[model samples]
Target: MHRMLSYAKGLLWLALCALFFSFSLLLPASAAVEGGYTIDLTPLLDALMPSLLGGVSLLASMVLAWLLRLLARYTGVVLDEKHRKTLHEIVVSRLQQIVTDSYEGNRSAFRISTKSEVVAELAGYAARKAPGAIRHFKLDQNGLEEFVAGRVGAKTLARLKSSPKHAPARLPPKPAR
Candidate 1:
């Protein structure tokens, strides 16, 4: 929008300059004769007007093309951002649902061996849910695994912290040798 405004200002300036130049050309010029001066510039102004208007028309067309290109690029960026945000929400929700269903009443531990299985299932689930986004965002197996593992670890830690049964135990005092 800001770019469009600047282009509009530039076009206004060009129009003003063209108007001033045409007015200046229309004013009569004085040429000295033997005993007097005569005013005449009709022929000169007639020849210049067509070429001047043509040049302005060409410049205006070029500016219009450039503005259209900028608008297309801006629209593409906004849509990509919207897709990315939607994909993130879908992945997070799916992860929570899978974790809840698989590990209910078993939050005491999230074993390292089972983490790979969970990640694999999550990748498949996401692919099924938003197939277009998976390709658009260029998500690979390694990236998906890392993302799932991180979220799972954080969730497990939060649950453990909140559970009284899993509270950290203090070590007893050591006896003097």
Candidate 2:
């Protein structure tokens, strides 16, 4: 439908151009020159007008096309930023739940600390800091979950269970005296 409308508009413009061409012929001719041929500058001026306007229109369309492309590109960037922020919040919340559950040994009492303002601050901090440490943290939740699960399986996690917030460092054995 749009293509048809554009074609119709082009045809109308062409008809108008033809009418203008014929109208120029009716313009009063200037006095006859030495060669006994009358030269009318009106038709020449009329002929130049369409070409000049077409050039200006072409330039205007090009500028508009560039502006439209730029708008689309920036709009996509903004939407992606918004989506990232929302996803960051979700990931932070999920991670906080998992951490709280694992630390408390069960789902019970998990919400007690999580409901606090301090938990929110901590979640926001992890969301910002952890993404840089884990390359695909923001892009994939399953990947992040697997990563956390893997870390939980490490020896440090067992030590954390016994020690809570403090894990004592293991020193190397001294050589026999």
Candidate 3:
């Protein structure tokens, strides 16, 4: 549906452009003279046609590209939710791996695409491992690196090291009726 809409919009724009171009070509090739100033319509049209058409095409392409980007972002969010749900343990392990690698000066393990996701996952782990300590301080990339390396503070690190690796169980299912 979205692709069809985008294609329909493009076709509409093309039709409008064609109509304008044909209309322009139908105009009489007359020169207007006012005192010492003179303007030749043919020359003006010849100079402007390519530029105008190119500008219109560029505008249409930019709009289409923007629409595609929005659609991808929406779909990506839905897929990310499903991925997280189905692979919760794997995600936790990956988050830990990234954090550990980052602490060891290999920050490239969590590049731009997954930077925010890594941060969010690591924050969850921290919150679980140290219930209240992580909330007391801001944890940006650097802070997370420090926290992962037991450099944030001894108390927090102690709690984290002693805490169980597994996430706490969510609420149990209600009794089956």
Candidate number achieving the greatest TM-score relative to the actual structure: 1
Model 1 clash pairs?
Answer: none
**Candidate 1 lDDT over residue span 1-177, tens digit each:** 587668667777877887788676544332244438665666866887786677688667878887887897877876677767776777678766654533343445433235566667666677788778777778787876675566566565455335444335445799989
**Count of clashing residue pairs in every prediction:** 0, 0, 0
TM-score of 3: 0.27
**What overall lDDT goes with each candidate model?**
0.64, 0.53, 0.54
Model 3 misplaced stretches (Cα beyond 4 Å): 1-24, 27-45, 77-177
TM-score of each: 0.41, 0.26, 0.27
Which residue pairs collide in model 3, if any?
none
Off by over 4 Å in 1: 1-76, 98-118, 147-157, 160-177
Q: Name the best candidate (by lDDT).
A: 1
lDDT of 3 by residue, 46-101 (tens): 88789667867866786787788789787776555554343344435655575454
Per lDDT, what order, best first?
1, 3, 2
